[model samples]
Target: MAMPAAEIEALIRAALPDAEVEITDLAGDGDHYAARVVSESFRGKSLVQRHKLVYEALGGRMGGELHALQLKTEVPN
Candidate 1:
């Protein structure tokens, strides 16, 4: 089963309440997604750490329910 975009957004938001998350269906197949996440909490976090946060928010659904995710994270300037 593929993870819904809303679920993705909700999960991220649950973890980072001040995040601005945008999810795109890259292949229009619901399994592949591209997400741009902007959050104040990511301000001082390393790139790897930021990605880890997003992955953690997904709750281990990455290679199972969700096939591929092209993720980008940024902190507000």
Candidate 2:
């Protein structure tokens, strides 16, 4: 099962309340996704850390409901 876009968005928002997020279905199968997220909370985090925070929001759904995620993150300027 693939994670729903709304679920993904909600998760991110929960982690970063002021986040700006865009999600794209790469395969249209709901298994693969590309997401761009911008948030103030990412300010001091490294790229790996930023990505980890987003993945953590999924709460262990990565290999289950979620298949793959291509993520891009940026801190607010």
Q: Which run of 10 residues does model 1 get worst, by summed lDDT?
A: 1-10
Q: lDDT score, residue 8, model 1?
A: 91
Candidate 2 C-alpha lDDT tens digits along 1-77? 86788899999999889999999999999999999999998999999999999999888898889999999999877
The regions of model 1 sitting more than 4 angstroms off are none
- The C-alpha lDDT values of all candidates are 0.95, 0.92
Task: Report lDDT (Cα) of residue 26, candidate 1.
Answer: 94
Q: Indicate the TM-score of model 2.
A: 0.95
TM-score of 1: 0.96
Q: lDDT for model 1, on a 0 to 1 scale?
A: 0.95
| RMSD (Å) per prediction | 0.6, 0.8
Report residue 17 deviation for candidate 2 (angstroms).
0.6
What would the C-alpha RMSD of candidate 1 be, to one decimal place? 0.6
